[model samples]
Target: MISFELLLGVAIVAGFVGAMSGMGGGIILIPALTLVGIDIKHAIAVSILSIIATSSGSASAYARDHITNLKVGMFLEMFTIIGALVGASITIASSTRPLYIAFGAVLLGSWAALLFAGHASWHASTQDGFTRWLELEGSYPDQALGETISYKARRAYYGAPAMFGAGLIAGLLGIGAGAVKVLIHDLIMGLPPKVSTTTSNLIIGVTALAGTSAYLAAGLIDPGLAAPVVLGVVLGAFLGTRLLVKLTNKAVRRFFLVVLLVLAVEMIIRGLRG
Candidate 1:
Protein backbone atom coordinates (compact mmCIF):
# COMPACT_ATOMS: atom_id res chain seq x y z
CA MET A 1 0.00 0.00 0.00
CA ILE A 2 1.12 3.54 -0.65
CA SER A 3 1.89 5.82 2.26
CA PHE A 4 -0.40 8.72 3.14
CA GLU A 5 2.10 11.24 1.84
CA LEU A 6 2.35 9.29 -1.36
CA LEU A 7 -1.41 9.21 -1.68
CA LEU A 8 -1.47 12.95 -1.25
CA GLY A 9 1.12 13.30 -3.99
CA VAL A 10 -1.06 11.26 -6.31
CA ALA A 11 -4.02 13.42 -5.34
CA ILE A 12 -2.07 16.58 -6.21
CA VAL A 13 -1.32 15.30 -9.67
CA ALA A 14 -4.88 14.09 -10.23
CA GLY A 15 -6.24 17.38 -8.92
CA PHE A 16 -4.20 19.39 -11.41
CA VAL A 17 -5.29 17.21 -14.30
CA GLY A 18 -8.97 17.15 -13.38
CA ALA A 19 -9.09 20.91 -12.87
CA MET A 20 -7.26 21.61 -16.12
CA SER A 21 -9.80 19.45 -17.84
CA GLY A 22 -12.70 21.05 -15.96
CA MET A 23 -13.71 17.61 -14.66
CA GLY A 24 -13.92 18.58 -11.01
CA GLY A 25 -11.42 17.00 -8.64
CA GLY A 26 -13.70 14.11 -7.69
CA ILE A 27 -13.63 12.54 -11.13
CA ILE A 28 -9.94 11.88 -10.79
CA LEU A 29 -9.58 11.63 -7.03
CA ILE A 30 -12.20 8.94 -6.44
CA PRO A 31 -10.50 6.48 -8.74
CA ALA A 32 -7.18 7.12 -7.10
CA LEU A 33 -8.67 6.65 -3.67
CA THR A 34 -9.96 3.23 -4.69
CA LEU A 35 -6.43 2.11 -5.43
CA VAL A 36 -5.27 3.24 -1.99
CA GLY A 37 -7.57 0.93 -0.01
CA ILE A 38 -10.41 3.40 0.35
CA ASP A 39 -13.79 1.86 -0.46
CA ILE A 40 -15.88 3.29 -3.28
CA LYS A 41 -18.49 4.63 -0.85
CA HIS A 42 -15.87 6.46 1.16
CA ALA A 43 -14.16 7.64 -2.02
CA ILE A 44 -17.40 9.24 -3.12
CA ALA A 45 -17.81 11.06 0.15
CA VAL A 46 -14.30 12.42 -0.19
CA SER A 47 -15.06 13.25 -3.79
CA ILE A 48 -17.82 15.55 -2.56
CA LEU A 49 -15.35 17.37 -0.38
CA SER A 50 -12.90 17.76 -3.23
CA ILE A 51 -15.62 18.99 -5.60
CA ILE A 52 -16.60 21.76 -3.20
CA ALA A 53 -13.05 22.92 -2.76
CA THR A 54 -12.29 23.04 -6.47
CA SER A 55 -15.58 24.68 -7.31
CA SER A 56 -15.34 27.33 -4.61
CA GLY A 57 -11.72 28.00 -5.40
CA SER A 58 -12.45 28.49 -9.09
CA ALA A 59 -15.90 30.15 -9.10
CA SER A 60 -14.54 33.66 -8.73
CA ALA A 61 -12.54 33.71 -11.95
CA TYR A 62 -15.40 32.31 -13.99
CA ALA A 63 -17.80 34.78 -12.38
CA ARG A 64 -15.46 37.75 -12.76
CA ASP A 65 -14.95 37.01 -16.44
CA HIS A 66 -18.70 36.86 -16.84
CA ILE A 67 -18.32 33.52 -18.51
CA THR A 68 -20.71 31.95 -16.06
CA ASN A 69 -24.32 32.08 -17.17
CA LEU A 70 -25.93 32.62 -13.81
CA LYS A 71 -29.46 32.57 -15.18
CA VAL A 72 -29.11 29.23 -16.89
CA GLY A 73 -27.12 27.76 -14.05
CA MET A 74 -29.68 28.72 -11.45
CA PHE A 75 -32.64 27.66 -13.51
CA LEU A 76 -31.30 24.23 -14.32
CA GLU A 77 -29.79 23.94 -10.88
CA MET A 78 -33.31 23.93 -9.49
CA PHE A 79 -33.93 20.52 -11.02
CA THR A 80 -30.41 19.27 -10.40
CA ILE A 81 -30.65 20.18 -6.72
CA ILE A 82 -33.91 18.33 -6.48
CA GLY A 83 -32.45 15.40 -8.32
CA ALA A 84 -29.44 15.27 -6.06
CA LEU A 85 -31.67 15.18 -3.05
CA VAL A 86 -33.59 12.28 -4.51
CA GLY A 87 -30.44 10.46 -5.46
CA ALA A 88 -29.28 10.88 -1.93
CA SER A 89 -32.54 9.57 -0.64
CA ILE A 90 -33.25 6.66 -2.96
CA THR A 91 -30.27 5.31 -4.88
CA ILE A 92 -30.31 1.54 -5.08
CA ALA A 93 -27.10 -0.22 -4.33
CA SER A 94 -26.15 -3.79 -5.27
CA SER A 95 -22.43 -3.99 -5.60
CA THR A 96 -21.52 -0.87 -7.56
CA ARG A 97 -19.29 -2.97 -9.85
CA PRO A 98 -22.22 -3.37 -12.19
CA LEU A 99 -22.85 0.25 -11.53
CA TYR A 100 -19.31 0.80 -12.77
CA ILE A 101 -20.24 -0.96 -15.96
CA ALA A 102 -23.11 1.45 -16.36
CA PHE A 103 -20.87 4.32 -15.42
CA GLY A 104 -18.37 3.28 -18.11
CA ALA A 105 -21.14 3.15 -20.64
CA VAL A 106 -22.30 6.61 -19.65
CA LEU A 107 -18.75 7.92 -19.73
CA LEU A 108 -18.39 6.61 -23.23
CA GLY A 109 -21.68 8.18 -24.13
CA SER A 110 -20.57 11.51 -22.71
CA TRP A 111 -17.36 11.24 -24.73
CA ALA A 112 -19.18 10.45 -27.94
CA ALA A 113 -21.68 13.19 -27.32
CA LEU A 114 -18.87 15.68 -26.95
CA LEU A 115 -17.25 14.57 -30.18
CA PHE A 116 -20.45 15.12 -32.14
CA ALA A 117 -21.73 18.06 -30.12
CA GLY A 118 -20.72 21.21 -31.99
CA HIS A 119 -19.52 24.38 -30.39
CA ALA A 120 -22.44 26.37 -28.98
CA SER A 121 -23.67 29.36 -31.02
CA TRP A 122 -26.36 32.01 -30.68
CA HIS A 123 -30.09 31.40 -30.92
CA ALA A 124 -33.27 33.33 -30.23
CA SER A 125 -34.96 32.70 -26.92
CA THR A 126 -38.48 31.38 -27.06
CA GLN A 127 -41.06 34.00 -26.19
CA ASP A 128 -43.77 31.57 -25.17
CA GLY A 129 -44.66 29.00 -22.52
CA PHE A 130 -42.28 27.37 -20.02
CA THR A 131 -39.24 28.82 -21.79
CA ARG A 132 -39.88 32.28 -20.45
CA TRP A 133 -41.09 30.86 -17.16
CA LEU A 134 -37.76 29.14 -16.46
CA GLU A 135 -35.72 32.15 -17.59
CA LEU A 136 -33.25 29.70 -19.06
CA GLU A 137 -31.76 31.86 -21.78
CA GLY A 138 -28.69 33.96 -21.17
CA SER A 139 -25.10 34.79 -22.31
CA TYR A 140 -21.55 35.01 -21.01
CA PRO A 141 -18.19 36.46 -21.98
CA ASP A 142 -15.48 34.48 -23.70
CA GLN A 143 -12.97 33.48 -21.06
CA ALA A 144 -10.35 32.75 -23.69
CA LEU A 145 -10.42 35.76 -26.02
CA GLY A 146 -12.23 38.27 -23.87
CA GLU A 147 -15.12 38.26 -26.33
CA THR A 148 -18.66 38.25 -25.07
CA ILE A 149 -20.44 35.21 -26.52
CA SER A 150 -24.17 35.59 -26.07
CA TYR A 151 -26.52 32.64 -26.51
CA LYS A 152 -30.05 31.50 -25.75
CA ALA A 153 -31.36 28.17 -24.63
CA ARG A 154 -32.41 26.04 -27.59
CA ARG A 155 -35.01 23.67 -26.06
CA ALA A 156 -36.09 24.64 -22.60
CA TYR A 157 -38.30 21.66 -21.81
CA TYR A 158 -35.83 19.21 -23.28
CA GLY A 159 -32.93 20.82 -21.48
CA ALA A 160 -34.67 20.64 -18.14
CA PRO A 161 -35.09 16.91 -18.53
CA ALA A 162 -31.42 16.62 -19.39
CA MET A 163 -30.47 18.63 -16.32
CA PHE A 164 -32.68 16.46 -14.18
CA GLY A 165 -31.09 13.34 -15.57
CA ALA A 166 -27.65 14.81 -15.06
CA GLY A 167 -28.53 15.62 -11.50
CA LEU A 168 -29.68 12.09 -10.83
CA ILE A 169 -26.49 10.64 -12.25
CA ALA A 170 -24.48 13.08 -10.19
CA GLY A 171 -26.34 12.06 -7.06
CA LEU A 172 -25.78 8.39 -7.71
CA LEU A 173 -22.18 8.50 -8.91
CA GLY A 174 -20.75 11.50 -7.07
CA ILE A 175 -19.33 12.97 -10.29
CA GLY A 176 -19.06 16.72 -10.62
CA ALA A 177 -22.23 16.76 -12.76
CA GLY A 178 -20.47 18.96 -15.32
CA ALA A 179 -20.14 16.13 -17.79
CA VAL A 180 -23.85 16.28 -18.43
CA LYS A 181 -24.29 19.91 -17.46
CA VAL A 182 -21.71 21.11 -19.97
CA LEU A 183 -23.29 19.04 -22.70
CA ILE A 184 -26.72 20.48 -21.95
CA HIS A 185 -25.39 24.01 -21.84
CA ASP A 186 -23.62 23.59 -25.15
CA LEU A 187 -26.14 21.56 -27.11
CA ILE A 188 -29.42 22.42 -25.44
CA MET A 189 -28.82 25.82 -23.89
CA GLY A 190 -26.71 27.17 -26.77
CA LEU A 191 -23.82 28.39 -24.70
CA PRO A 192 -20.22 28.41 -25.90
CA PRO A 193 -17.72 25.88 -24.56
CA LYS A 194 -15.99 28.35 -22.29
CA VAL A 195 -19.26 29.58 -20.93
CA SER A 196 -20.68 26.11 -20.44
CA THR A 197 -17.56 24.83 -18.72
CA THR A 198 -17.30 27.84 -16.45
CA THR A 199 -20.97 27.90 -15.62
CA SER A 200 -20.94 24.18 -14.90
CA ASN A 201 -18.09 24.82 -12.50
CA LEU A 202 -20.14 27.49 -10.78
CA ILE A 203 -23.19 25.28 -10.41
CA ILE A 204 -21.59 22.02 -9.31
CA GLY A 205 -20.72 23.41 -5.90
CA VAL A 206 -24.40 23.90 -5.34
CA THR A 207 -25.18 20.43 -6.63
CA ALA A 208 -22.49 18.75 -4.52
CA LEU A 209 -23.73 20.40 -1.38
CA ALA A 210 -27.13 18.80 -1.78
CA GLY A 211 -25.67 15.40 -2.55
CA THR A 212 -23.00 15.40 0.16
CA SER A 213 -25.51 15.40 2.94
CA ALA A 214 -27.08 12.21 1.65
CA TYR A 215 -23.73 10.54 1.14
CA LEU A 216 -22.80 11.41 4.70
CA ALA A 217 -26.10 10.22 6.05
CA ALA A 218 -25.46 6.91 4.35
CA GLY A 219 -22.25 6.64 6.34
CA LEU A 220 -19.94 6.96 3.37
CA ILE A 221 -17.73 9.88 4.39
CA ASP A 222 -14.10 9.68 5.53
CA PRO A 223 -12.50 12.92 6.57
CA GLY A 224 -8.93 11.64 6.58
CA LEU A 225 -9.03 10.86 2.88
CA ALA A 226 -11.30 13.77 2.04
CA ALA A 227 -8.93 16.33 3.50
CA PRO A 228 -5.99 15.36 1.34
CA VAL A 229 -8.10 14.92 -1.76
CA VAL A 230 -9.76 18.28 -1.32
CA LEU A 231 -6.44 19.93 -0.76
CA GLY A 232 -5.05 18.28 -3.84
CA VAL A 233 -8.11 19.16 -5.92
CA VAL A 234 -7.90 22.80 -4.94
CA LEU A 235 -4.25 22.97 -5.88
CA GLY A 236 -4.92 21.12 -9.12
CA ALA A 237 -7.83 23.32 -10.05
CA PHE A 238 -5.58 26.37 -9.91
CA LEU A 239 -3.10 24.83 -12.29
CA GLY A 240 -5.75 23.36 -14.58
CA THR A 241 -7.55 26.69 -14.95
CA ARG A 242 -4.28 28.20 -16.08
CA LEU A 243 -3.92 25.62 -18.83
CA LEU A 244 -7.54 24.97 -19.86
CA VAL A 245 -7.04 26.66 -23.20
CA LYS A 246 -3.48 25.67 -23.86
CA LEU A 247 -4.37 22.10 -24.73
CA THR A 248 -5.82 21.38 -28.15
CA ASN A 249 -9.56 20.77 -28.35
CA LYS A 250 -9.19 17.37 -29.92
CA ALA A 251 -6.61 16.44 -27.35
CA VAL A 252 -8.89 17.49 -24.55
CA ARG A 253 -11.81 15.45 -25.83
CA ARG A 254 -9.71 12.41 -26.57
CA PHE A 255 -7.99 12.58 -23.23
CA PHE A 256 -11.26 12.99 -21.44
CA LEU A 257 -12.70 9.94 -23.18
CA VAL A 258 -9.69 7.80 -22.47
CA VAL A 259 -9.63 8.76 -18.84
CA LEU A 260 -13.31 8.07 -18.50
CA LEU A 261 -12.88 4.67 -20.06
CA VAL A 262 -10.09 3.77 -17.70
CA LEU A 263 -12.06 4.78 -14.68
CA ALA A 264 -15.10 2.93 -15.93
CA VAL A 265 -13.05 -0.22 -16.41
CA GLU A 266 -11.46 0.22 -13.03
CA MET A 267 -14.80 0.44 -11.33
CA ILE A 268 -16.08 -2.59 -13.21
CA ILE A 269 -13.12 -4.71 -12.26
CA ARG A 270 -13.35 -3.69 -8.65
CA GLY A 271 -17.05 -4.36 -8.57
CA LEU A 272 -16.62 -7.80 -10.09
CA ARG A 273 -13.51 -8.67 -8.15
CA GLY A 274 -15.05 -7.88 -4.84
Candidate 2:
Protein backbone atom coordinates (compact mmCIF):
# COMPACT_ATOMS: atom_id res chain seq x y z
CA MET A 1 0.00 0.00 0.00
CA ILE A 2 1.19 3.48 -0.68
CA SER A 3 1.99 5.38 2.49
CA PHE A 4 -0.34 8.20 3.44
CA GLU A 5 2.51 10.67 3.73
CA LEU A 6 3.78 9.83 0.27
CA LEU A 7 0.36 10.16 -1.30
CA LEU A 8 -0.17 13.44 0.47
CA GLY A 9 3.13 14.77 -0.76
CA VAL A 10 2.43 13.76 -4.36
CA ALA A 11 -1.04 15.21 -4.19
CA ILE A 12 0.35 18.52 -2.98
CA VAL A 13 2.69 18.79 -5.92
CA ALA A 14 -0.03 17.70 -8.33
CA GLY A 15 -2.40 20.28 -6.97
CA PHE A 16 0.14 23.05 -7.23
CA VAL A 17 0.91 22.25 -10.84
CA GLY A 18 -2.73 21.74 -11.69
CA ALA A 19 -3.69 25.11 -10.32
CA MET A 20 -0.76 26.83 -11.97
CA SER A 21 -1.56 25.40 -15.39
CA GLY A 22 -5.34 25.12 -15.10
CA MET A 23 -5.11 21.41 -15.68
CA GLY A 24 -6.73 19.74 -12.72
CA GLY A 25 -4.46 17.81 -10.35
CA GLY A 26 -5.77 14.50 -11.65
CA ILE A 27 -3.42 14.68 -14.61
CA ILE A 28 -0.53 14.33 -12.16
CA LEU A 29 -2.18 12.38 -9.35
CA ILE A 30 -3.56 9.53 -11.48
CA PRO A 31 -0.19 8.54 -12.89
CA ALA A 32 1.51 8.69 -9.50
CA LEU A 33 -1.16 6.52 -7.90
CA THR A 34 -0.95 3.91 -10.64
CA LEU A 35 2.85 3.80 -10.49
CA VAL A 36 2.62 3.25 -6.76
CA GLY A 37 0.62 0.03 -7.30
CA ILE A 38 -2.89 1.32 -6.87
CA ASP A 39 -5.49 0.04 -9.31
CA ILE A 40 -6.05 2.50 -12.17
CA LYS A 41 -9.81 2.59 -11.72
CA HIS A 42 -9.52 3.41 -8.08
CA ALA A 43 -6.81 5.93 -8.80
CA ILE A 44 -9.08 7.59 -11.35
CA ALA A 45 -11.91 7.80 -8.86
CA VAL A 46 -9.72 9.44 -6.29
CA SER A 47 -8.22 11.73 -8.89
CA ILE A 48 -11.65 12.92 -9.90
CA LEU A 49 -12.38 13.71 -6.28
CA SER A 50 -9.13 15.60 -5.95
CA ILE A 51 -10.06 17.68 -9.00
CA ILE A 52 -13.05 18.93 -7.08
CA ALA A 53 -10.82 19.79 -4.21
CA THR A 54 -8.36 21.54 -6.49
CA SER A 55 -11.10 23.63 -8.04
CA SER A 56 -12.68 24.43 -4.73
CA GLY A 57 -9.38 25.59 -3.33
CA SER A 58 -8.31 27.77 -6.24
CA ALA A 59 -11.39 28.80 -8.20
CA SER A 60 -12.74 31.02 -5.45
CA ALA A 61 -9.42 32.78 -5.17
CA TYR A 62 -9.34 33.44 -8.91
CA ALA A 63 -12.91 34.63 -8.90
CA ARG A 64 -12.32 36.87 -5.91
CA ASP A 65 -9.33 38.41 -7.63
CA HIS A 66 -11.56 38.99 -10.68
CA ILE A 67 -9.35 36.83 -12.84
CA THR A 68 -12.10 34.34 -13.66
CA ASN A 69 -14.66 35.07 -16.35
CA LEU A 70 -17.77 33.79 -14.64
CA LYS A 71 -20.06 34.31 -17.62
CA VAL A 72 -17.81 32.28 -19.88
CA GLY A 73 -17.28 29.56 -17.29
CA MET A 74 -20.98 29.09 -16.70
CA PHE A 75 -21.80 29.13 -20.41
CA LEU A 76 -19.28 26.47 -21.35
CA GLU A 77 -20.12 24.25 -18.38
CA MET A 78 -23.42 22.96 -19.74
CA PHE A 79 -21.86 21.04 -22.59
CA THR A 80 -19.05 19.65 -20.48
CA ILE A 81 -21.41 18.21 -17.90
CA ILE A 82 -23.23 16.23 -20.54
CA GLY A 83 -20.03 15.04 -22.14
CA ALA A 84 -18.62 14.02 -18.77
CA LEU A 85 -21.65 11.82 -18.04
CA VAL A 86 -21.35 10.05 -21.35
CA GLY A 87 -17.62 9.65 -21.11
CA ALA A 88 -17.70 8.22 -17.60
CA SER A 89 -20.18 5.61 -18.69
CA ILE A 90 -17.96 4.69 -21.63
CA THR A 91 -14.87 4.32 -19.42
CA ILE A 92 -16.53 1.64 -17.31
CA ALA A 93 -16.76 -0.68 -20.33
CA SER A 94 -13.85 0.33 -22.53
CA SER A 95 -10.09 -0.11 -22.78
CA THR A 96 -8.23 2.98 -21.61
CA ARG A 97 -5.06 2.55 -23.67
CA PRO A 98 -6.51 3.89 -26.90
CA LEU A 99 -8.11 6.75 -25.04
CA TYR A 100 -4.82 7.66 -23.45
CA ILE A 101 -2.97 7.66 -26.72
CA ALA A 102 -5.67 9.63 -28.47
CA PHE A 103 -5.78 12.23 -25.73
CA GLY A 104 -2.01 12.57 -25.84
CA ALA A 105 -2.13 13.13 -29.56
CA VAL A 106 -4.66 15.87 -29.10
CA LEU A 107 -2.46 17.53 -26.52
CA LEU A 108 0.53 17.21 -28.78
CA GLY A 109 -1.34 18.97 -31.53
CA SER A 110 -2.39 21.72 -29.17
CA TRP A 111 1.17 22.15 -28.01
CA ALA A 112 2.41 22.42 -31.55
CA ALA A 113 -0.25 24.95 -32.42
CA LEU A 114 0.59 27.11 -29.46
CA LEU A 115 4.31 26.85 -30.08
CA PHE A 116 3.95 27.85 -33.70
CA ALA A 117 1.93 30.86 -32.70
CA GLY A 118 5.23 32.25 -31.37
CA HIS A 119 4.24 34.48 -28.47
CA ALA A 120 1.32 36.06 -30.24
CA SER A 121 -1.07 36.65 -27.36
CA TRP A 122 -4.78 35.95 -27.68
CA HIS A 123 -6.62 39.24 -27.58
CA ALA A 124 -10.28 39.38 -28.44
CA SER A 125 -10.34 42.06 -31.06
CA THR A 126 -13.87 41.24 -32.11
CA GLN A 127 -16.85 39.35 -30.78
CA ASP A 128 -19.50 37.60 -32.78
CA GLY A 129 -23.15 38.43 -32.42
CA PHE A 130 -23.79 35.36 -30.29
CA THR A 131 -20.79 36.01 -28.06
CA ARG A 132 -21.66 39.64 -27.69
CA TRP A 133 -25.23 38.79 -26.78
CA LEU A 134 -23.97 36.45 -24.09
CA GLU A 135 -21.71 39.21 -22.81
CA LEU A 136 -18.74 36.87 -22.61
CA GLU A 137 -16.17 39.54 -21.79
CA GLY A 138 -14.34 40.88 -18.75
CA SER A 139 -11.29 42.68 -17.44
CA TYR A 140 -8.85 41.79 -14.67
CA PRO A 141 -6.00 43.51 -12.86
CA ASP A 142 -2.72 41.86 -13.80
CA GLN A 143 -0.03 42.05 -11.17
CA ALA A 144 2.80 41.17 -13.54
CA LEU A 145 1.84 43.73 -16.19
CA GLY A 146 0.85 46.40 -13.68
CA GLU A 147 -2.33 47.18 -15.59
CA THR A 148 -5.83 45.92 -16.19
CA ILE A 149 -6.29 43.47 -19.06
CA SER A 150 -9.66 43.35 -20.74
CA TYR A 151 -10.83 40.76 -23.26
CA LYS A 152 -13.91 39.52 -25.07
CA ALA A 153 -14.59 35.92 -25.92
CA ARG A 154 -15.50 34.96 -29.48
CA ARG A 155 -16.33 31.84 -31.48
CA ALA A 156 -18.79 30.36 -29.03
CA TYR A 157 -20.00 28.04 -31.75
CA TYR A 158 -16.64 26.36 -31.83
CA GLY A 159 -15.78 26.66 -28.15
CA ALA A 160 -18.96 25.03 -26.81
CA PRO A 161 -18.59 21.83 -28.82
CA ALA A 162 -14.90 21.68 -28.09
CA MET A 163 -15.58 21.86 -24.38
CA PHE A 164 -17.84 18.85 -24.76
CA GLY A 165 -14.88 16.98 -26.15
CA ALA A 166 -12.74 18.20 -23.26
CA GLY A 167 -15.37 17.01 -20.79
CA LEU A 168 -15.45 13.64 -22.44
CA ILE A 169 -11.70 13.25 -22.03
CA ALA A 170 -11.91 14.40 -18.44
CA GLY A 171 -14.55 11.81 -17.58
CA LEU A 172 -12.79 9.02 -19.43
CA LEU A 173 -9.37 9.72 -17.94
CA GLY A 174 -10.20 11.45 -14.66
CA ILE A 175 -7.97 14.30 -15.76
CA GLY A 176 -10.46 17.19 -15.54
CA ALA A 177 -9.27 18.04 -19.07
CA GLY A 178 -8.32 21.52 -17.98
CA ALA A 179 -5.48 21.65 -20.47
CA VAL A 180 -7.84 21.15 -23.37
CA LYS A 181 -10.29 23.59 -21.87
CA VAL A 182 -7.55 26.18 -21.60
CA LEU A 183 -6.59 25.61 -25.18
CA ILE A 184 -10.14 26.06 -26.35
CA HIS A 185 -10.49 29.18 -24.28
CA ASP A 186 -7.38 30.69 -25.80
CA LEU A 187 -7.36 29.33 -29.30
CA ILE A 188 -11.03 29.30 -30.06
CA MET A 189 -12.54 31.87 -27.73
CA GLY A 190 -9.71 34.37 -28.03
CA LEU A 191 -9.34 34.85 -24.30
CA PRO A 192 -6.11 35.90 -22.66
CA PRO A 193 -3.91 33.17 -21.21
CA LYS A 194 -4.45 34.24 -17.63
CA VAL A 195 -8.18 34.43 -18.18
CA SER A 196 -8.17 31.03 -19.85
CA THR A 197 -6.36 29.41 -16.95
CA THR A 198 -8.44 31.05 -14.26
CA THR A 199 -11.71 30.43 -16.09
CA SER A 200 -10.71 26.84 -16.73
CA ASN A 201 -10.16 26.46 -13.00
CA LEU A 202 -13.68 27.66 -12.34
CA ILE A 203 -15.23 25.31 -14.93
CA ILE A 204 -13.44 22.11 -14.00
CA GLY A 205 -15.20 21.57 -10.69
CA VAL A 206 -18.64 21.33 -12.25
CA THR A 207 -17.37 19.01 -14.97
CA ALA A 208 -15.76 16.75 -12.36
CA LEU A 209 -18.94 16.64 -10.35
CA ALA A 210 -20.82 15.28 -13.33
CA GLY A 211 -18.23 12.54 -13.81
CA THR A 212 -17.88 11.72 -10.10
CA SER A 213 -21.44 10.47 -9.88
CA ALA A 214 -20.73 7.77 -12.44
CA TYR A 215 -17.67 6.57 -10.53
CA LEU A 216 -19.48 6.65 -7.23
CA ALA A 217 -22.32 4.62 -8.67
CA ALA A 218 -19.81 2.04 -9.82
CA GLY A 219 -18.37 1.91 -6.29
CA LEU A 220 -14.92 2.89 -7.48
CA ILE A 221 -14.25 5.65 -4.98
CA ASP A 222 -12.17 4.63 -1.97
CA PRO A 223 -12.60 7.16 0.77
CA GLY A 224 -9.51 6.13 2.69
CA LEU A 225 -7.14 6.86 -0.17
CA ALA A 226 -9.05 9.93 -1.29
CA ALA A 227 -8.94 11.65 2.08
CA PRO A 228 -5.30 12.61 2.20
CA VAL A 229 -5.21 13.47 -1.50
CA VAL A 230 -8.10 15.88 -1.16
CA LEU A 231 -6.54 17.59 1.84
CA GLY A 232 -3.13 17.90 0.23
CA VAL A 233 -4.40 19.14 -3.13
CA VAL A 234 -6.55 21.80 -1.50
CA LEU A 235 -3.55 23.10 0.37
CA GLY A 236 -1.38 23.13 -2.72
CA ALA A 237 -4.07 24.66 -4.87
CA PHE A 238 -4.35 27.56 -2.46
CA LEU A 239 -0.63 28.15 -2.73
CA GLY A 240 -0.73 27.98 -6.52
CA THR A 241 -3.53 30.55 -6.79
CA ARG A 242 -1.53 33.01 -4.71
CA LEU A 243 1.47 32.66 -7.01
CA LEU A 244 -0.40 32.51 -10.33
CA VAL A 245 -1.94 35.94 -9.79
CA LYS A 246 1.54 37.41 -9.57
CA LEU A 247 2.85 35.91 -12.79
CA THR A 248 2.71 37.34 -16.29
CA ASN A 249 0.48 35.87 -19.01
CA LYS A 250 3.52 34.85 -21.00
CA ALA A 251 4.97 33.05 -18.00
CA VAL A 252 1.68 31.19 -17.50
CA ARG A 253 1.60 30.26 -21.18
CA ARG A 254 5.13 28.94 -21.01
CA PHE A 255 4.35 26.87 -17.95
CA PHE A 256 1.26 25.44 -19.61
CA LEU A 257 3.18 24.55 -22.76
CA VAL A 258 5.92 22.77 -20.86
CA VAL A 259 3.51 20.75 -18.77
CA LEU A 260 1.41 19.80 -21.79
CA LEU A 261 4.45 18.56 -23.69
CA VAL A 262 5.74 16.51 -20.76
CA LEU A 263 2.46 14.93 -19.79
CA ALA A 264 1.45 14.21 -23.36
CA VAL A 265 4.66 12.36 -24.08
CA GLU A 266 4.56 10.44 -20.82
CA MET A 267 0.99 9.28 -21.33
CA ILE A 268 1.62 8.24 -24.92
CA ILE A 269 4.69 6.26 -23.89
CA ARG A 270 2.80 4.52 -21.11
CA GLY A 271 -0.03 3.60 -23.46
CA LEU A 272 2.33 2.28 -26.14
CA ARG A 273 4.31 0.25 -23.62
CA GLY A 274 1.17 -1.34 -22.34
The segments of candidate 1 whose C-alpha lies over 4 angstroms from its true place after superposition are: 90-94, 110-128, 143-149, 249-258
lDDT of the candidates, in the order given:
0.71, 0.81
Name the best candidate (by lDDT): 2
Q: Which 10 successive residues of model 1 have the least lDDT summed?
A: 119-128
Question: Which lDDT tens digits does candidate 2 get at residues 1-274?
Answer: 7899998888888788766654557766776676677776777778887888777667888899999999999999999999988888888776767656765676686577656654546655799999999999989999998999888889999999999998998888787777689889988999999899889988999999988999999988888898988898888777876687422478877876887788679768877887
Q: After superposition, how far is residue 116 of candidate 2 from its true place, in Å?
A: 6.7
Candidate 1: tens digits of C-alpha lDDT, residues 125-243: 54446666766555665546667655555576787778888877777777787878887877776666776778888788888888888888777776766666777767766777777
The C-alpha RMSD in Å for every predicted model, in order, reads 2.9, 3.8
Judge candidate 1 against the unseen true structure and give its global Cα lDDT, from 0 to 1.
0.71
Give TM-scores for every candidate, taking all chains together and pairing residue i with residue i: 0.84, 0.81
Model 2 spans > 4 angstroms off: 17-23, 96-118, 144-147, 239-274
